[model samples]
Each structure stands twice: as structure tokens, then as C-alpha cells.
Target chain A: MTPYDYRDLDPLIHSRIRLSILAILTSVEDAEFTYLRDQIKTTDGNLGAHLRKLEEAGYVRVSKSFVGRRPVTRYRTTEMGRGAFRDYVGRLEWILHSRPMDADQREAG
Target chain B: MSEANARQQAGDDLAVIRRLMEDARETVSNNGWHLVLWGSVLAVAEVFDYWAESGTLPVSPRVVWSTALGLGWGISIPLRRWSRKHAAVDSLANRILAAIWIGCGLGLMLLGFCGARTGTLPGPVTPGVMAIVIGTAFFASSSLCDRALFRMLAISWWALGSTMLIWPHPANNLVMSAGMVLFMAGPGFLLTRRAGKPARMELVA
Candidate 1:
């Protein structure tokens, strides 16, 4: 109903791709770069960019290792990211449920 | 934004989270090769031990078990390395599952070899102790993965172990062998079958 009510929603996690990435990471302990790309149905470059944004925000942690000769990258959500996601979801729920009350108040006023 | 648009966006976001979480759980739970391999090996070893105990086989029980356990470890170590190298994802559930089973294996080795040789654990009651340890592992695994099948197996192992401990008869060897085949190998085969079906369908597609 007002900008103040939506202030708690994280802009970084508001985008569809970033939201999807967080959702996937929250579900599993860790996931490989290729796994996330395939699940999100995005190109490597696009996925990598979103991942980097989240990494810079300290919302995700990446680990690099070698499986024989080939290098592998894995990602997981950090504690801060988990907390932010929870707050975002809680705020979203509040917004969804409080809209009717706000509408009723506006009509009365 | 309009109320209708905001509501739609919220619904879509929640749906995406729900669907992806379910998919991740399904993918992580599909692994069953280690269970199948270990179950088959243990089942065969228990059966051979039963035969030797019954005088149906002339070989010593000690020799049969040692060779069987040795062979199991020899194969399992390499197999685990290969699986870890090839795994597409490393989940917390998988790690906990591996740790539970690895700890179970070490407990069995200590009870079977060290405890027995040192006379700290009597030879006759060793199987019962091992069974209890296996049951505990299965219980832990069931709790971790939320699988009813593992809980049932845990109960079965506990019952078998209790029965052997109470009776303490020579014929319990045959009973233990039967328990291994029915409980361990049977579930292993079922898990392997379920895990393989998706791969086969993918190949066909």
C-alpha cells in the first residue's frame, strides 16, 4: 500500500534470476556451477554475472577445486544471505496479507 | 505496482522456491550404489559364515569373514573415490549420510577384529553388537533423509540383534544370514532399481 511497507524487501534478491539462485542454494548445501546453470536454464555468462553480484554482496560463497585435470566451482549461500532471504520472505508475506486492511482503511478515510 | 500484479509476483516467486527445493531433494536422494554394493558383500559374507559354522563348508569362519571384509574394503575405497570425483553436486545430506556409513564401517571393524582378537568382546556376542551398530546407523540415516524404509530396516536390525543376544545359539548364524539377505540386499536392490530408472529414461530420450 505504501513504499514504507515494501522497504524490507531486498533489491539484490528482488530480481527473478537472483531470487531463483538463492532459492536453489538454500535448498542444497552446495551446488556446482553447471548444476545451477542447467536448473536456471541460463547461459554460463548470464549465470556467472548474477552469481558474481550475489558473491560481491556477501550473499554467496564460491569454492574452486580440481576434479582430476578439470576445475570445478561450487556455490553455497552464506549465513547473512540466509538471514536476508528469510527477512525478504517474511516481508513479502506481510505485504500480501496486509493489503486488504490497507484498502479498507483507505476507503474509510 | 497494482495489487493484482504484486500478488501475482509473490505467488510466482513462492512457486519457484517450492519447485526447486523439491527438485534438489529428489536429485540428492537418488544415490544408492554404495548401499547396494555393501549390502551384497555383507550378505554373501554372512551366508558363507553360516555355511562354515554349520560344517557345510570346510573353511574356517575366521578365514571366510576376513577375506570377505578385506575384499569389501578393497573395492569400496576405490568406488567411493570415483563417485566423489564424478558427483554433480555435494549436498549436506549426502555428506552426513557418508559420514554415518563410514563411522558404521569403522565401528564394525573394531568390534569384529580388534575386540574379538583382544577378547574384550566375546566371539559369540560380536554379531549382536555389530547388528546394533548397523541399526543405529540406519536410524540416524532415516532421521537425516526422512525415509520410512530406512527406519523399518533399523527396526529389523535391532530385532535381529536382540534375538541373537537373547538366544545365543549356533543356529543364529543361519538366522543372521537370512536377515542380511532379506533386510540389506533386498532394500539395496530396490534402491538401485529406483535410482537406475531415471537414467534409463534419460538415455532413451
Candidate 2:
């Protein structure tokens, strides 16, 4: 397969946990940190680190607030994040459908 | 990875994404108690009003309606608070559903109490308008959550409301009451039964 076929696949969203986070956020307006933690089935530290990475990349926006005495943190996908996810999925679909015959033909030549 | 393995991995990733999205959407549609509570309250009030108007009950219609509204609000507020506090996920769909129902309730209240007292809206037409408002809410909810049952409920409410509007009669109270039972309470009960308990998750330490 040519490098062009899969080159556009987003490296940041290709991981399982980050991909799952984006998928969940895409389905809802926002989600609590604990909800993401439970859904991803990952350790708090692991989820936090990945979230920080996504936040730094401007893919996720975080909001912190107090519910009574407890502090609550919520996350939402940024517009860029949504766009990236859509593009990532699109690339995956294209790669899955495209055959590697061009590379084979080049080898035969 | 081999081409076949890459394809299989891509397919698996898509499947996981689909499952998570479905799970998130499902959370917004699990609220059933709100419907059952309001339906029961309204049904009881309608029946009591019917009996009183027919001279079978000794209570005043005003007293019955007042108590019914009072009880419905009294329970609904706390229940809403509790649910909000306990919810694991709060989606836009949930917020939209709440807004729709709350708006419908307030609109009905203003029409029923203020409109009736001001001699603008006749008492006989109040129920029909209320049903139409409720049906509109059900329709919004059906569209939001993609529930066919809610669509059916919307149609049922519209049909009942139209009947009451077209044919003004004392027995319309009974018909409205039955609509509450069949469309509102029955669906609420079914939703409650169909709602699955939240799956227990094993957290990583």
C-alpha cells in the first residue's frame, strides 16, 4: 500500500483510550471525568494523562466546577477534535476499502 | 500488520466506537419515573373532578385539582434533584428532555390557572390545550431519543386532545383520564420495566 493511503490517519486519535474518549464525547454534549474513567476502564492517572495530552492538543476542553462541596470536572470535544475524529474515521474507512494492487503492480513491473 | 489483520483491527475499532456511542445515548433515554408520577397525579385529579361534577363525590373540583398539582410538584422537584445528583452522564438529550417537559408544565399551569381565572379560557377547553402541549413535548422527546413508544404517545395525546376540543362534554374528563393511564402511565411503567440496571464496572486501582 502507498504511504498516501494511511498517511492521513490521525496519530493522536489512533490509540484505544483516546479514540474511546472522543467517541463518547461525540455522542454526548459533555461527560464527567468519572464517567469517562468508568467507560474507558482505565486508571485515573492513565485517563488524566491522555486527557491532558488531548487538552494540550486543543482536541478536548475541560471545565471544572463545584457540585455542593465536591469538585467536578467535565470534558467536551472541541470543534477541531470533532473534525479530527471525523477525518480519522474517514481515513480508516478508505484504507479498509482500498486494495494494495498498485503496490503489487509496481513490484511486478 | 498484514492487510487482513489491519482490516480486522479497523473493523474492531469501529465496533468499539459504535458500542460506546450507543451506551452514551441510552443513558439519556432512561428517565421513566417522571412520566409515571405526573400521569398518575393527573389521572387521579381528572377522575376526582369527574365524580364531583357528576355529584358522586362531595369534594370541590378546585380542592381536588389544587391538591393534585401540589402533590405532583412536591414530588417532582426532589426527584429531579436526586436524579441530577446521581446521574453518571448528562447529555444534551437529557437537558433538552427536561426543558421540554418543564416548559410544557409551566405553559399548562399558566393556561389552566391564570387563563381560567381571567375568564379568557373556558375550563372545558383547558384539558384539550394541556393535552396538545403534552403531545408536543412527547413528540420532541420521541425525535430526540428515537423512541417509537413516545411517538405513539404523542399521537394518542393529540387525538385525545382533538376529541375533547371538537366535542365539549363532561365525560371528556374520563377520556382524558384514560389517556393518562394508557399513554402516560402505561408507557412509563413499561419503560421502568425495560430499563436495565447499570452494569457494575471493575475499576483499575
Q: Highest DockQ: which candidate?
A: 2
Pairs that collide, model 1:
none
Runs with alpha carbons beyond 4 Å of true place in candidate 1: A1-8, A41-46, A63-65, A69-71, A96-109, B1-12, B25-31, B118-125, B192-205
* Tens digit per residue, CA lDDT, model 1, B56-164: 9999878988898888889888987887676666678877888898999988987888886788877567777778888999899886664788899999999999988
Q: After TM-score superposition, what is the CA distance of residue B173 in candidate 2 from its true location, in Å?
A: 1.6
For model 2, what is the alpha-carbon lDDT of residue A6? 42
Q: Over the stretch A1-109, how does candidate 1's per-residue lDDT look in tens digits? A: 3522344479898877788788778878888898777777777898899999999999999999998899999999999988988887776765566667776676578
lDDT (Cα) of model 2: 0.82
The Cα local distance difference test for each model comes to 0.76, 0.82
Error of 2 at A67 (Å): 6.4
